[model samples]
Target: MRRRISMLAGVAALGLTLAACGGGGETPAEDSNAQDASGNVGVFTWWADGSEKAGLDALVKVFGTDYPDVTFDNLAVAGGAGSQAKSVLAAQLKAGNPPDSFQAHAGAELQDYIDADQLEDLSSFYTDNDLTAQFPADLVDRLTVDGKIYSVPSNIHRANVVWANVEVLKKAGIDPEKPAEDLEGWFADMDKIKATGTIPLAVAGSWTQVQLFENILLASLGAEGYNGLWDGSTDWKGAEVTDAIKAYEKALSYTNTDRDSLSDWAPATQLVQDGAAAYNVMGDWAEAKFAQDGDKPGVDYVYFPTPGTEGVFDFLADSFTLPKGAPNPAGAKAWLTTIGSAEGQAAFNKVKGSIPANTTAKTDDFSEYQKSAIADFGQDTIVSSLAHGAAVPVAWLNDLSTAVSKFGGDKDIDTLQSSLGDIGEKFAK
Candidate 1:
């Protein structure tokens, strides 16, 4: 489970062997060489550490077995949630020096790449690989643009989970088994935890703040209202939105005061694992981290959908796309094939704390939390996750993140609401 994938690029000498075996020794066109097909496939992602990196390593293993000739050049840039990698990737794509394939969110966030003509049409890749019938139809639809699929989703993650340390909750005289039924109930429990001198909630800076705000929005506005936020229907200044903002403000009060100093979501989750905090609202990936640290799911830590979000799935997918003009087009396609395959997905999600996007993947090896996630994904009302870059364009998400960061410092609800209104108007147009 803690295996590290070797990121070494196979020696360039192997490309010569491949070329020599193909026919008479007439050198092939640079773009038509086998190296371009199955040589070093530059696999790009932000999975620089933790279970996320382990999962990528797992997938890389699968790719190596499937195509022994191809070398995996792991181009991972370390930053929480692709914050640093995305900027690097954008520059690469803009300069036409694209990686063979790169990780991306599977919804509207991909529209920018599609708009910029940086991605290859992957519709035929789906059909050729028989993936059209293997992946969820709705997921396929979300990944499609202009009647063509562009990315292959590796796994699905739920964004509305709250991870709590059972011991911390018990110390606070709160029942760990019975999580709050609503936002008000959550506040009441937070009060009790506060009295016990534990950090009532643990939150990290930047994107994690947006993740919390979005879940709070889901809890306050319900699934329908939450969906309306991405579309043109939800009024950002409405009373429901106001209520959500108020709830977010109150919830912020219970968070660790040192939250601003925490750079990543894992540290916030660590607070819960170390029993310094009662709750950490985050994606299910935290479960994988806990498991890696030898914590049992129900005993050491427990999870529930963030309060008031019981029947909803704030969902996002980690996907990979074939960038146009890739150096190793063949290797890229092979990598995508493995990503969309049942065996590959099963291997990846088992370590990554997500459910396979491929429905045929067996869940027998998944953890208890992952099993519950599979069930929830099957029945819950699905909505795009704003924090994970599924619900809006990249620019809009950046703007929203900036607004949330400012709100964190200023606590100005009116200004925050106005900014959201402007973002909505700009994106809607």
Candidate 2:
């Protein structure tokens, strides 16, 4: 999947953290003076908002109750997308005084930490706590490397969803319940939205917006063709891949923003919420914004899997890795274990509006559309992550972003297809 932005339209994006599941560990050296009867844990994350902070604080409250002696230093390092936090983490890890635990996404993101040998081995932690039986084998495997577990996934989020305003669809005389079934159907619906004077697709043409392009291509090409282009399994020059790129080019033309200077995702989010734009391609977490605005799913807003890949769920799971030389290694390992626990996942994601990574976590409070996502999680046909971020190297994905932005501006299918082919051919090596 692509990099996750805050799902709440007006709110800043929130990052994740790590904690252990079962119990106290011997306090590490950095926290030697900080330890008491309770395990002292230092956590670093990027969540900044009253509600988001409250939600996280609720997790802290739970942790405190379970481990009363545990002390916590909530470090708020603010910057968009953890740009500052990552830098601080690198320094701390190098200095051997890192936070007890920190955040990173699941999948390839964990590879770097594993290769650096900074993270504690959690194979024993997972087995002792029975986490292996709790989380899905695929998810466990994605977090595990070379027989060592370095991180614990916090939650699973579906990325390939189109959030549409129900009233806008109704105004366009389109059925809110049953969306267009295929790519042509998607265009027909968007055409109706445009005809109704609604921006067909709300978008910002920034690098991150390229994830939507990948989502659209995934729909057109299906998993095999899309993954092939990224993982060296398929030739990007093949007609099928070209056709997928062409489909994305056609969709790009329907975007609401001007090509010169695009709006940011927050404003694009507002455009859809305010009904100025009919739809926004975003992750399921964005539902939190709609809920905050007092909108009900299927009534005020409707979420549909991107057209043409209705049953194929594309997902991203959030995880936290212990940076090398973490200040509180034992506490960090404890945090990772906590993140993988069903209770902690459910508690954290409930406020965050994401599905718990542990399959056993109850999802009774999720909204109608979110419940649908929980159902999809049970099905084995889902792809773990989309190609834009975790599944492929960041360098290749950046190239794809450039190609997408070019397509968004030129609206030329041939040019876009050639660019994708060129990039794909190189990455396939």
Task: Specify the highest-TM-score model's number.
Answer: 1
Off by over 4 Å in 1: 1-36
Q: Model 2 over residues 1-429: C-alpha lDDT tens digits?
A: 222221100001123332332134544523422223345567776545433454567567666655566666677555423433554565455545556666544555444445555666656767767888987776666555666776666777787888898899999999988987788899888988888878888876554357677687678777666656656677766777677777776677788656335533455666788988888887765776677667777777888888887777776766665555455555555566567667777777777667887878777876677678877766624654433245654455557767777766677777777777787677655
Model 2 steric clash total: 15
lDDT of 1 by residue, 243-349 (tens): 89989999999999999899899999999999999999999888789988999877899999999999888888788877777766777777888898999999999
Q: Weakest 10 consecutive residues, lDDT, candidate 1?
A: 7-16
State the displacement of the C-alpha of residue 139, model 2, in Å, after optimal TM-score superposition.
1.7
Per lDDT, the best of the predicted structures is 1
